[model samples]
Target chain A: MTIGSQVKQSLANMKAIHATLQQLALTSTNEEAQRAFHEAMLETEQMIAALKGRISTLEREEPQYKGM
Target chain B: MPAWLEVAIRSICILIGLFIITKLLGKKQLSKLSFFEYIVGITIGDIAGTMSMDLDIRLTEGVTSILIWALFPVAISHISLRSKKFRDFVEGNSTVFIKNGKILEDNLKKEKYTADELLEQLRKKDVFRVADVEFATLEANGDLSILLKRDKQPLTIGDIKPYVPEEKEPQTVIMDGKILDEPLATARLNRGWLKQQLDQMGVAIENVFLAQVDSYGQLTVDLYDDRIQLPEPQQKQLLLASMKKAEADFELFSLQTNDAEAKQMYEQQAKHMQQLIQKLQPFLM
Candidate 1:
């Protein structure tokens, strides 16, 4: 697959992980677990944002990859 | 020397010799002994027992026999380690009795194991149905190692992918009313912290029979007085519940709001909070 598609796939995986972490945080009864999950989710969100930015940059530089 | 005195001296000498020989033999003798080791152990024990009571056998001769018996096995084991063929000869090869859920009658006959005996062994392993067994082997030590079919296998933690926090062993800070300083240090806690915790609970350190600190730094104490019921720790649970309530409120705010920007912000916060809760589920739960 192209670099764009690979990056998109990674981005998708990160989002899924973030969603799972969020779900765990909501469902967890332990305070420590909830805190840990919330912290991890925030970190994952930052990574997702970073990936999104990279995708935008890639699309701008290579117009052919845009909307792929 | 009196005959009784001579007998006492001989028994003491034999006891020391037996202790030294057992020490040289290593811990394997204490655990599952191979067939060869079992026979060697029995022979040495019988010789020691005879040498202890019987005044006829000289101490020197008995000691020499025990030494040879003990050292020969040690030498054989060392040699077996270097040679696979020798190892197989000394520790007999394990026989496969069942393959692909079918018992091999020929192998069973070769091992002189009856169909009834195989079923009995299988039953001992909690495998009632022979058809459920995918692979079964009779170990050299007479242990039946059985592997169930894929469908019959129990589900493990690996089957479901979830974030599980690594837990450190609970440190026993107090045992029998005495504070263990080393364990407290290992748990990264000091006496002041422990004192404060005890004081908060209104439990005297002397009254506590056992106290353990878990990975979450929650101190659990058992008092000598069984009638006194200490409240269970619920701080973490309460905090998690409050966080969930906040997340719910955010969702409600997002739904009730008319302003597009305000609604979007509230929705984003709710989503973020939800993700945070999901991440903490394993540890908190």
Candidate 2:
């Protein structure tokens, strides 16, 4: 698979993981468990955001890539 | 046991090997490298670094790893160049975020870009208003390519100037005292005509440094000695005739065009050309 597609797939995976973590954070009775899940979800969201930025960067460079 | 000497020799070998491999790879700058290539470069550098300093690993083992890392990227790059599918897989496709002054919401969502970010990008392109953009694409390299709407685009010489001269490409007839046959043919002139021109300028073909014929069939010759000065002749009649033809064409366009804006533009052009002709009348006399 292309690096771009892999990054996109990773982004999707991260989003799914983030949604699950959010749900877990809400359902957890223990305050510590809830906080940890929330933190993990935030980190996953950040990763997804970074992946989106990477995809945009790759898309922008395509014309030069074609010339190469 | 002089283990230090062996380590030093191994380090030198690794350095030389990495240098040669790097030179073998084409001179694509780090900034120009795609994400995959960038990762490959880092991996290769890491392998080289491990080989250079680590005494625990066998020198041959490290060198082999380095070669594999470097050659794999080169091979992939070759394959990518040969296959469009491979290239597309390696580099994602660019998406159009805006088309015909309308924001492509679906595409924006797919790209995970917010409408506010799109507006910011448009602003960076000097497009203050979204309505002014005809098309805006988010390229794979993260660049925003924008085309302004027709009416919003900056005016060119053709928009205001009455006379739009015919587009003609210049042809080189001679270079370094040697007459190029292909350019001469492209210019639709023979050696005889070239020789005649050279004779008119009192220059021999062997002494001519460069000679080019412009679209208007005007010849400019430069000599190797740089002593000769060629006088440029101004033809008042040619200019007057072209002006008159342009005035007539604009008047004709104004009559035939049904588009209000185009008709108005043509009328204004005709008026401008008429004024130009009047100003040139004294010069013609």
Candidate 3:
């Protein structure tokens, strides 16, 4: 509902996608598919880290939105 | 010219004429032919046969007759294209044989289609039960098109609301021990990649009978020697299973977590993961 909650929801989805991609990377027999999934997982991890930073900045700017 | 030589020349001439006429007529004759087109075809063949053997009829006369027969059909088709009424008249209207799960005996009699014939056509379509058919029609091309009852219809992608990834046509990268460069390029792969894959599989290029690269980038090979077996590709299945397991783990985490926020996040993530699995199911399965 709130911007913080929205961000948290997005973060959750990103984490799930990342986990799925990591699983695929580990389990895939095809070399190209494995490499692709691994790369996508790394990219998603960076995005998750970036989103976490955004959430921290939001928390500092709007204290009411923090821990909500 | 000798008598035998004359007949040989005539036959060759008729054969060439038939080829040219058929080419000019286009692919319409290759598909279902209308009754008129069928009659014209038989007449042309008869004329060609007579002209080839019977020296009494001049070759020019036979050619003229065949040309008239071919031209009239072409002209009729061109006219039929411009006029819906004329097209219906020329091709004949598609007759309905069944409606609302009921066989129309009057329509069947009009089309002179016997019950056995109708049953045979339905069987060819793999529909054994006439009760399952909601509507059936005899197309102008003589094809029996049938629609099964709503409850009898097979499940399709639309029935299940899942996001299905579009699949590209697979490329035949190898055939008869020869690597096709064009198809490999179409598949966005190179000879080096193919060689490496073949090497990994312990299969030589020369020993491969056929090989295809699917949308998932999985290469499947049929070997010249049928005795040897290659392991089936299971990357899709493995990926799907892993995703399912991850989804189950998230659900379990949601159940076990004490913090309300963490529990909510896990539940939402599990739901999202389930959606992703649904999206990928069509391709993976």
Worst 10 residues of 1 chain B by lDDT: B234-243
lDDT of 3 by residue, B1-285 (tens): 898999999999889989999998889977746877888888888988999999989877888888899899999989988999999888999999999999999999998999999999999999999999999999987899999999999998777855545556788999999999998887777898899889989999999999998866678999999999899877667667766765676677567646577578667767766776665566567
Distance (Å) between predicted and true CA of B209, model 2?
4.7
Scored against the true structure, residue A27 in model 2 reaches a CA lDDT of 37
Worst 10 residues of 2 chain B by lDDT: B276-285
For residue B223, model 1's alpha carbon misses the true position, in angstroms, by: 3.5
* DockQ category of candidate 3: incorrect
Q: What lDDT does model 3 reach?
A: 0.80
Model 2's TM-score against the true structure: 0.43
Quote the chain B TM-score of every prediction: 0.85, 0.50, 0.80
Q: What tens digits encode model 1's per-residue C-alpha lDDT throughout B158-219? A: 56856566666888999999999998887677898899989999999999999998766678
Q: How well is each residue in B1-285 modelled by candidate 2, as lDDT tens digits?
A: 477887788778778877788887878625644767777788888887776677788877877788788888788888988999998887767899888788899999998999889888988878889989989898876788999999999999678766543435778999999989998777666798789868987889999888887544457888888777776633335445644665675576568646576567657756765765664443332
Provide the interface RMSD of candidate 3 in angstroms, 1 decimal place: 8.3
lDDT of 3 at B10: 95
lDDT of each: 0.80, 0.70, 0.80
Off by over 4 Å in 1: A1-68, B160-168, B253-263
How do the candidates rank by DockQ, highest first? 1, 3, 2
Which of candidates 1 and 2 is the stronger one according to DockQ? Answer: 1
TM-score of chain A of each: 0.96, 0.83, 0.94
